[model samples]
Structure formats: C-alpha cells, structure tokens
Target: MTCPPPTATLRPGQLRDPFRLLMDVTARHDGLVRLGRGPLGVYIVSHPDYIRRILVTHSGNYIKGPLMKPFRTALGNGLVTSEGELWKRQRRLMQPAFHVRQLQLMESVIVAAVDRAVDRWAAAAETGRPVDFLDDCIELNVEIVLGALFSTSIDPARAQRLRELTSEVFAGLASKVWTFFLPSWFPLPGVIRYRRAVAALDAEVHALIAERRAAESTPEDLLGLLLDTVDAETGAHMSDQQLRDEIFTLFMSGYETTATGLTWAAYELARHPEIAAKLAAELDGATARPRPTFAELRSLEYGKRVIDEVLRLHPPFPIWFRSTVAADDLGPYHLPANAKIVLNPHMTHRDPAYWSDPETFDPDRFTVGRFGTEQRHAYYPFGKGSRMCIGERMSQTITQVALSAFTGTFEFSVAPGFEVVPQYVVTCQPKGGLPLILRRR
Candidate 1:
C-alpha cells in the first residue's frame, strides 16, 4: 500500500498557538493539507469523502497513532486505543451497558446530577453572582458518568483527586506536539508529569478495583458487569491492568467531551436570549419536571437540536489523528505510506460546500428529517467507524437530561466579554470557564 507522492507542498511554521494555528490552517485548505515539521507533522482532512475513507471505509489502515498514546499510557490498552480483536472484544463486552434500552436505567442518575449542579446555580442566582457554567457542567458530567458506571457512589474526596490528576495528565499532554515519540525514560517535564500522573491514577484505580472485588455481593453496575464479562472464545476476563485502562478511558472520553458540548450549548443559549426563550418554551410545553425521563427525551426535540448544533460548531474531539499504514490516493493528492493523517471535523462541520451559512448556529438545520438523512461524513461529532465513541448514546442522553433539567429551572445569559476559546488536549474544551448569569424564571 505505497502512497502516491505529495501533490501540494507541505507548509512550515511554528504553531505556537494551537487554536489560532488550527483556525488559520482550516480557513485556507479546501480539504487535506500537510503542515508543520518533525513529529508534529499535521495533515488536515476536511473533505467528506476523505473523512469517510479514514474513519470508515478503509479505517483499518490506521491505528490510534501518536496523538492518543499519552492517554493510552494512563489508560492502558483499553477500547479507546486497542486495535483488532482486542478492541472488538472489549467493545463487545462494553456495548451492552450503553445500548439505547439500557440508557433508560441511567436517566434518573443523570437528572440527579444535573439537579445538584442547578441547585448551586439557583443559589448563585439568589445572590446575583454569575455561575461558572463550564466548571459546573464538567463537574456534573463527571458525577453522571461515575454514578451511571459504578453501583457505589464515588467518594467525593477521591473523585476530586482523580479530577485534578486527570486535568494534570491532559494539560501536560496538550503542551507538546510529539510527547509520544519521547521515550518513557526521558527526563523531560512532560515525560515526568505523565509518569507521575500515571502512577497516581494507577494507585487510585487499583484501590477501587480491589474494593469492588472484595465485596462479597456483586451487583449489576458497570464494575460488576466488567468483572463478569468474559470473552466467548477465550473464556478470559479483563486483567487488573485492563480494568483500570477501561475505567480511565471511560472517565477521559465519556466525561470531557460531553461536558465541553454541554458548556458550548449553554454558551450558545446564553448568547441568544430569544433562542433560549424559544427552547424554554419548548421545554415548558414538552414535559413536566422533576426531571424529564429518558422516555421523555423524544419530546425534547428542540433541546436535542441545540446539542446537535453545538456539536457541529464546537465538536468535542476536533482534529482526529491517524497514521497511514498503507499509502493510497485521496482525491487528487497522493499520500505516502506512514503519512500522519489528520481528519479535521472542525473544518468539515463548517465546510461551505456541505452546509449553508456554515458559521451560524442554526438548530433548525438539523430539524427531525435533516440529521439522519444528511451526508454522514459532513457530521462527525462522535466521530465515524470502528474507533467511533462507544459512549455516544449515553453522552447524548446525559446532555439532553442536563439541558432539559437546567433550562427548566432557570434563565441563562452570558457575562459581558465572555469569550469562548477552544483548546484541545485529548478533547477540545473551552479555554476558560464559561461565566454566565443564571436568573430564576
């Protein structure tokens, strides 16, 4: 699978600022463009067909590549990075927990978490202080994932520790272009931080796994389910290392993306008072609160559209990194074997070729008949293909529940000069917390 010679000259520059760099690069390139030098070599793929080739049609030609290894170091060979039969087996075992039907069982937990966060906002509203929506959403999503994934409650103190450690891991990983290429023994700050974070995370995970294993009675939560899961052919279950890996993967992938999406959705609503009012009206007409049940999510179509629109404009995982195992021709360009390929959903979601007024935040564009029937490659908030996010449905459910619960309880407005800048670590997140005033209706 030798790749064809490059058609366009690779550009060179010091990408001192990742956000500005990405915005500028995507603004010019029609589809795929090679940029940067050394191990930070970036190939931006914005075309729908090109994305399809990398993520779906011929996805096997790529593995998880350099971008994801820091996370892999922390999480081990779990579904997020494992390839071939290993990923398939783990994904199969984990898929049942995230099935559409199973999601209903987790709805109450999601609502409870949302309500907890909103209660704080309500308090803040009474005092006339702006609530940090981004921080609240991030914390809320973490609680939701922990509650739904494990039977027992996560100790708040321990959970806080994990959050700090996880943030450190992602922050360190985000700083460099090719931290993955550095040997694990390297004494650099990034390497040292990765090593320290890994040890801390491993210690926490092992303690939790041990506690769960020692419990005389096993229940139906994610931990118990993972314990019980066995491969059909090998009759083998996950090793301790594997268990830790999966849980860490779930924590990283499941929490950050959903949290970021929720933050953006809220930011959008805050920016447009009329839009928020319209959504609030829809919420008022659609369902009665305590909190809308998973069954009631279908009636919250407008809310779902808001989330979908957020995903389009500010996707959680913006640029996907994949290595070309075998080089093949992509449109007019010939990619060489082992070429570092980057699939840019950030640009594709806004591709003028596929979307009208691609820069606008129009939920109506995804009105019922629009989303499922639209071209698949044009929208990839959860990504595409075998390595696609396994927690997609669950994340959507959590977002819907959070939005419905929060919006039902209060009115939202962004604070003045509240700029939303995106920064990508393992996931794309708002650079600063989204500060917004929450007024009681």
Candidate 2:
C-alpha cells in the first residue's frame, strides 16, 4: 500500500513512541510509512505482501538493513547481522550445524542442561522459596548452547558470565547513553564497555576454536564443523574474524530467543493455573515418571501450544529491518534504492484481521495441524521464507523439553498481584524478574 505522506520530522532519539507510531502509520497508511526526509528517510513496511516482497520474493533487493550496523560491529559480519556475499558464505559454512539430523545429536546435552536447572529449582521449591524463572531460564539455555557449541559440558560460573555478557551487549543497544552517540561518531564509555565484552567473548570463542582445531580427533561438533568448513568453489575458509562472529551469532541467537520463550511460557503458565493444570495433566497422561525424550516432549502438544501462543503474543525478535538493494515497487509503494525498511512481526501477530481475539491469551487457537494454513500466515514467530530461523527445530525442541520437565515435577504460580508485563529491549522479556512460587507435585 502507499506510504503515508511524511508529516513530521523524525529525529533518531526523538522518536519515543515506536510502537504507537508504527501502529498509527500501519493503520492510517495501510502498513507502510515513510519517515524523515532526504537520503536517509526510513521506510516502514508492515503489510504482509510488501513484507513478503522485501523479505522473500524480492529479498535480494534488501540486506539486513541499518539497525544491524551497531550489532554488526560486535558480530563482525556474522549471519544474524550480515549481508551480501559474506552472509551467503557464513550461511553455507554454518548450514550443517542446524540441520535437523545434526541438531538431534545435541538433544541429550539440552535435556541434561534442563535437568540440571530443574534440579536447582526443585531444591528451592523444597525449601518453600521463590525462584526467578527468568534467570533460571537464561542459565539453562546458555548452558545448552555452550554444550552444543563445544560438544562438552560447561562450568557453571564461566557459562553464567558468558550469558551475562551477551545480554549486556544487546542491552547496551537500547541504552539512551549508548544510542545518543553513534559508534563512529564517538567511542563513549558505554561503547567501550560493549567493546570490552565483545573482546572477552572473542578471546573465549577463538580459544575454543583453536583448541578444537588442535585436537587430533574428529569432533563432529559445531565448533569442529566450523573449523573444517570451506568455500567449496574457491576453497575459501572462515577467517578468524568470521569464525568468532559466526560463533558469537549462534551463541547469542541460540540462547536469548529460547530463554525469552521459556520465560514467557513460564509467566503464562503461572498466570493461568487452569491451562497449567491441563498441560500438567497432558504430561502426566504420557509416560510414568521418567525424563522426557525428544519424542516424549513432542507428544506434549498442549505445552507446545502454550509456547506457540506466547511466541505469537510476545515474539522474541520484535522488530527487524531490511535495506533496499535497488529501487523496487512493493504493492502501491515505490521503495527507493538503499531505503531502510522496517518490519514489525510484533504488530502483525496482534493484527486483528489475522488473529482471532488477537490480544487475549488463547492457546487453543494453535491446535495441531492448523499452522502453515491460510488462516495463520500472519502468525509467523520464526519469520518466513528462506531467512526463516535455521534453529527453529532446535529451539522448539528445547522449549518443549524444558516445559515438559518442569510441569512433570512442579506446579508454579506468580506471586500475588504480579502482572506479567512485556518489556521490549532486544527481546520481549518480563519487565522485571519473573518470580514464581513452586509447589512440588
């Protein structure tokens, strides 16, 4: 649809009402708006068709977009925040690690991490104490990613610090102090802190890469695969920079998104005991008192449904951007070459036209055999097309395992009068810590 006429001058930091502004633009202009003026005006595309054009049909006409510039500094042309031939190269190199069959090899590691975290929480519950599910979720998934990446268990303290550093780096992006100055314009103290964190992570990743490379054994792990991957045509291989960036990308993407999903799912279950009871019953109805395997976790359809609905309502990556590679017509709007285009899956997920009772918490809407149908096109939590999350299967599997394990052992409740509010930083996290009181089953 045609973009709304530029009515107001939008400076970078002056735009406080991102969500409301985008909603108004989408509603008034039919899912597209051109903000600012001159060479750098941002083109916001919210329509599914135009989004498809920019992200799928004519995806080559766009790159990862400018929002990634800051992250690209930390990521250094990694898959999550890189574009062009570099992205293609990294995608090819990293493709095998996320393959469904390959990911299955990491299932035991994931379950062990979940069980370890659950055991800690079980001890807390036994003492009649509250546990911050948010912290616990982050810790569990961080360990899982570390194990999968290295193909070996991680020491808890080292893993915790890594998780904290990743979150802090992204969190730095949303900081008013950080964003006020461009990374190029100045290397402020905040940027310095972020750089320090990046360097620390890089050292660890490179050390692992070196250690894995030196090992005589064929590890078959992600690190080993990355160490061995080469560009088939040119016989090119990942440079040390590429290696660190890609590993960092996988580590950040793997942990943060799953952690958010788990935290949100926990919040949902704690807020709705009836749904939790049903989910618990579904788990109970299955195998009798045993650890859930990938197969068993898949059978917890209701639990999966709950997580799906949560992802729909509170997507981890709430906003993504694409920069036009060349001038193109998208529906009624003619996007200029190099124009910045933003897509809001967060709004699309809540679009009343696509979702029934869009704002309400309704897990039943996602029954088995219903997704990928005509009715659910706007419900893309993992995004769409070729750029769809490669880690979706792995993330889904981990979520199911963690949720089923928790429900199998404990029933949880949000503390009295605690409302689970959505706070968007890098991901949609609970505004504060998601504290839940656990009653052992």
Candidate 3:
C-alpha cells in the first residue's frame, strides 16, 4: 500500500492514438498507470475497482471537472457539462421522456427513420454500389433523433444544416484540446469556427422553439414533452435557452454514439459469416416480418447478444474523464485533488481476466449464465453509476431496430482484401468509414 503506481512517459505525437497507448501502458502496469509528468500528466484507470470508486462509491468526491470545461462553452450548462444541483434537476426532468413507456411510444419514429434509410440502401444494393455504412447510419440516427424531438416539423434541408453545424462544432472543440496551453486571445481558426457553429445552431434551435410556442397546439414529441416540463420545486417551465441547451445536449449525445455502434456491428458481421448466419437465423425465427415491432425485436435473443458483444468490443464512448475533489487513495496509490483521471472502458472490456479469448468476435460470450460477478462489474459499455448515459434505453432501441432492419432485408460484404482500423476521437469509430457492398436477401 505504499509504492506509487508506475508512470509511463508519452512521446510526442502519441496523443493521436492515446487509447491504444493507454491500453498498452495500463495492461503492462496492472490495470493502472500514469502518463507524462507534472500537472498535465493523466492517470489512466482501467481497473473496475478504481472506476467504480470514482463513478459510484465516492462519486460525490469526483466531478466532471476542468476536463469537461470546453463542453460547457460549446453546449452551455446542459446535463453533460453541468454539475451538482443543476445536473440533478435536469436529470430528474429528463428521466421520464426516456422511460420504457415513452420509448415504446417512439418506436414508430425509430422504425420509420430506419426504413427510409434502408430504402436508399436497397436501391444501392440493386445497383451493386458500395455504400458508406457509417454515413448511412449517421444520417439515419439524425432523422430518428430529430423526428422524436419535432415529430414531422424538421425537413431534410434543416436536418442537414444542423448536422453540418454540429460536426463543425465537435471538430473545432477537439482541435482546441491539443492547444490548451495556448492563450485564449490566440487567433485559433478552430476556436473561431467553433464559436460561429454554436451561434448558428442556437439561432436554428431557437427559431424551432419559437414556432412551437406560437403554435395553436404542440405535437406529441420530445420537444413538446420538454416544453411542458415544470420543476417540481420551482414550478418554473423551461426557458427558451434551457430548451435549446437540452436539445443540443440530447443530439450531441445521441446520434454519433448510436451511429458508431451500428457501424462497428456491420463491420464485424461482414467479417464473421458463421456468426452472422446464426444471427440471421435467430432473426428469421423470431421476427415474422421484415420490420419488427418493439416487442418482437426484444424477443430476438441472439440478436441482443450480438448487440451486447458489439458494444463490449467497440464502445462508442471509449474513455471518460473525472477529477478528484480532495485527496484520496485508490487501493494503495494516492491522488491529490484535481488529479485528471481517464477511465478507459475500452481496456477493461477486453481484459482477459474478465473475458475469454479477449480479441475474438464471439457473441456467445454474452449468452445466458456465462458471467460471474466480477465479469459483470468489469463490463460497462454504457458506463456505470449515477451519471451513466441518460438515453440508454433509447440508444439501445435505435441500435437493435436498425440492426434488425438492415440484416433482415439485406446481405453485407466487403472487398476481398479490406481492412478497418479503429479511429479514436470524440467517439470510437471504424477508421476511413465503413464501405460495404450490400445486396438484397
């Protein structure tokens, strides 16, 4: 309980692939390690024990911290960046919209969006054209999220513009992370563009809110539900700015995560035909039609396992950051207040101690009665504890339904000598996008 945890020095340019380097360092150092030196050095914690400590047991002593300060600038005081009382209130108000019953009501919106995208994929399949699977998934998720929020209010052009603006904003924010040492007064193009993107997005979202406010009646959708939400204590309805912030938070959190998961799923399915056949068989036996209702889709046992394995292997949000509020010890090693802690679920998910044959594409790993308590605690594709993803149910539904529609109606293939590398950015995704050849089943 006395010696310090091993520290690994990061060479120049290694930040480009930090997750990979982190995995190597942490695995070699017994599930924990420090990178670099001084105040800027980061502590990488892959051990479930320390992760549960920071996120759950002693969650009160850890905050999203300075690591998430940039998001506050980009997204304002939304749930993702807000802390303490503000976060608690926002979570309470938002919880009901993602409830099981609410998500059930939104199934039609999810299915309809997937169907339209599949129709386009079908046309490409008939012509033997290779489709960018990631792009298709990204576009589909945008529709699903927007349709759930606005009912049928947002048209294609508006959706595309929103997508472009968000993409720009995220790109700008990520670029700024590497230049944190620079002065705020520095003339950085990314920061300037990020500011412009946020402004344009705010104008667009505010206009949408004003239209709903002036309407004779609001439609039954996420925006309408949120518009009517009143604080139990304050009795105050959400202001225009609050609604815009929540909308921005929901979109930023939802689309890319679901899209990245589906993209990895397709890549794995194409690479493993036997597993794909088993999944298709289960799909065929369980689902009586091309499209499954919410109930029918949940009954696909093997399909669910495939989804589980996909998430374990390719978690969308691979790593998250938190900082200590005061001095604390993780088992033996001690960390001072404001210590930058990087929790990498990507490493823990594949630890051989918790998983068998860690690198294999085996959905059966998630089959019934296979996991011990340690393995269960060690797996966290949706994160752990109080601040776990708010839209877990909605994200899973979108993912499962999209997988059903795509696999149920088509066959996926790749070039003979193709390879895909993982791109670790804001979200973990397949590098160079996934280009797959599709054919109708």
Q: Pick the candidate with the highest lDDT.
A: 3
lDDT of 2: 0.75
The numbered model that scores best in TM-score is 3
Candidate 3 — what's its lDDT? 0.84
The predicted structure with the larger TM-score, 1 or 3, is: 3
- lDDT string, candidate 2, 1-441, tens digits: 654434345656645655555555665655677866764367776667777777778788788866576666667878888777777777788888788777678887887888898889889899877888888898888788888877653466767677777777666655532141134575455777877777877787777777766777856577777878888867987888788888888877876789888888888777788898998889878878645676676677788789889899888787777787788887766776777677888787877777778888889988755555544667667878778877888888888888888877888888777777766665768878788889888
Per-residue lDDT over 112-200 for candidate 1, one digit per residue giving the tens place of the 0 to 100 score: 78878878888999998887887888788878777776745467788788778777765665664345545556666557777788788
lDDT of 3 by residue, 1-441 (tens): 655667898888887776688777877876778888885588889888988998899999989877776676677878888899988888888887898888977888998899899899999999887898988898899888888999888888888898888777776666665443344466776576788888998899999999999998888899999999889988988889878889988878875899999999999999997878787888888867887789887688888889999989998788887888998889888887888888889889989888999899888888667866888889888878999988888888899999988888888887555688887667888777888999888
Q: How does residue 99 of candidate 3 score in lDDT?
A: 89
TM-score of each model, in listed order: 0.92, 0.90, 0.96
Q: List the residue pairs that clash in candidate 1.
A: none
**Clashing pairs for predicted structure model 3, backbone only:** none
